[model samples]
Target: MVANLDASSKAGSVLIVGAGIGGMGSAQLLAQMGYKVYLLDSAPGIGGSMHLLDRTFPTDSCGICIMSPDQPSYCPTLECGMHPNIEILSYAEVESLEGEAGDFRALVKHRPRYVDIIGCNNCGLCVEVCPVERPDDHEGRLHEVKAIYRPPTRAVPDTYVIDMDYCTRCGKCVEVCPTEAIDLGMAARRSEIEVGAVILSPGYRAFDARIKGEFGYGYYDNVLTSIEFERMVSLTGSTQAHLVRPSDGAAPRRVAFIQCVGSRD
Candidate 1:
């Protein structure tokens, strides 16, 4: 419903600082209550921490599937990112905020997606031809990911993002995309949005396990992070969710975890 906004309008409006489930839920509620909501996140897609787990606790139900529209019991505002009255800006972050409560102004820095979100159809052709492969940061970088790849299958804003750091400028994905969505070069843009209130749901970042050299998080091939282990056992993850050692891709019979790697009294 909020196709455009005026900073001067002090009407009901909100700026949600993250696009995770919490942020999405808050935005949906505020919007349903007659407020213009804008959701933002640094990641290209939503789902946040839930997207990394193999199986949810207590119930083994698939995390992504359970969050779909059919699973209204889970989240009534499923696909909230694309909901009307709510606009989501992914691969973006709030650089600065000015003005007081109920009438705030913000500067959002949007990193280039390389692929146009409006044009992508999720055909997954770009992933097939893109030769650039690197450790997927989504799974805590446990699995391999193409330079141009989509988030989880059910992720909102079902679009692909390019890891420009490892992209070789080969333009293979660009050539293969059916919708011509891939752009090897895209410029970053900034948005100046105004809202009556702000809601922040920026999630926590995984602690770098490499700091504790004694634990061999990166030194030992067999050692893996908790997130990595979760990905290894994830049905949609690398090795087809097989419980295998990263060292030689062999089945692991038993595993041990060391807690509080960086946290100590």
Candidate 2:
């Protein structure tokens, strides 16, 4: 929920360098205490690592993994990105940070999605018309999603983005957008904003098992990372929400995961 747009930032605003769980949760807490927050992430949607994982820990519960459902709690999950005080800047990378502790300016490079965030309503028509397909990174590349797509149906911001790098500029999506939100010519925009404080949580990447070679990560299709395995078992994962082996696309009777493979963690 958003506070008044004109609620007034008496305490000044804070620029959060990442919209992951850490940055978003801090934004929500600070916002509740009366401070404007600019939440930024380099991805097309919020949730960061939370977005890729199919389920939460312990029992694979998805309760708070997706978007927060307007609840009342102090949960420090990435769901706080939906708060009104947090102005999410997805697909934005922070270029530089200037100034001292309390007064800082962040220079952000915003890559264009070619779709107007304000006008688009997350309709799947553009996806239906687009002929290009790519490995779904959100599903840990275990499956495919449209080149023009949203990371997840329940993803925050609820908007679609075009992977311009992989997109063929087919213009088919441009023609099919119902809200006229698709713009094939959108350019990268640079923005600078001032804030009282900065919180950096650029997020983390899973260890590349391919480099280790012992795990046969890239060599063996059957072997997968936790994130990839998560996608295989996730209710929202790419395998029609069911578990399946990647190599043969078969259901394995027994699954085994070695703890801290190639690491001390």
Candidate 3:
């Protein structure tokens, strides 16, 4: 897939790893200036850690509202969404690299889309019809998601993907899809690309709040990280952004925001 694109792009090819906020910004600037940019990431899509958090602090404003909506949104959280010129490869990875600056060969590994991107209308009927439901990783397992789902309402490219691991091969998504977009037989693909420069922007990882045993992060339902708390506060979130204890389903009156759990070191 990458090779097909590599051959099409003109001079000044740029390979960008980690399609986070920085990567998207850089790709747009370069593409607008007449550069053929190749953006890749190991995750299913871009948005990086930005999608995990609910909103920015201090003002308590919704991150999605403040961010630009013109670009493709990775999830419903408005702050992280769209960009026109960026070629996004979610569920992709880089296998190898060769050559040098001004011309480097990159081997890219692409996972199957499972659901057809072109035909599907994003009506979410497949999700409603499918029987299998799994942990919603976007919500940090706080809720369950259908086998097929859009990353969020704001997701760009406006497509839904199938969860091969959880999909029961029931063909429900395919049957319900008005556009015949579901294709369960797609396989992983590999391709190569040649680029002049590679910009790596692999972002940061969230510290496991479970490490601090005192808070009982994994054991108790009330305790959560900043990101989890943010989702709990979001009306679009799994819980409809309600701040309640998962164990009891009651709203929490006394909440503690613990800073520097891991960063103090």
TM-score, model 1 to reference: 0.86
| Models sorted by TM-score, best on top | 2, 1, 3
Give lDDT tens digits, candidate 1, residues 1-265.
2334443365468888877667766776676666777888788876677777656766887665455434444542345755688887878889999887666899999999898988989898888888878977766546678888787645667788888899899887878878888877799999898787788888777788888788877888898887778877888777667898777878989888887776652
Positional deviation of residue 144's Cα in model 2 after best superposition, in angstroms: 1.6
Better-scoring candidate (TM-score), 2 or 3: 2
> In order, what lDDT does every prediction score?
0.75, 0.74, 0.70
**Pairwise TM-score winner, candidates 1 and 2:** 2
Model 2 CA lDDT for position 6 = 34
**Count of backbone clashes for each model?**
2, 1, 11
TM-score, one value per model:
0.86, 0.86, 0.84
Give candidate 1 regions above 4 Å deviation: 1-10, 63-77
Can you give the lDDT of residue 10 in candidate 1? 55
The per-residue C-alpha lDDT of model 2 at residue 51 equals 60
Q: In model 2, which residue pairs have backbone atoms overlapping below 3 Å?
A: 2-84
Per-residue lDDT of 67-174 in model 3, one digit per residue for the tens?
Answer: 433344343322223434456666788899888666788899998878777787778788789898899877885888888877753444458887788888998777
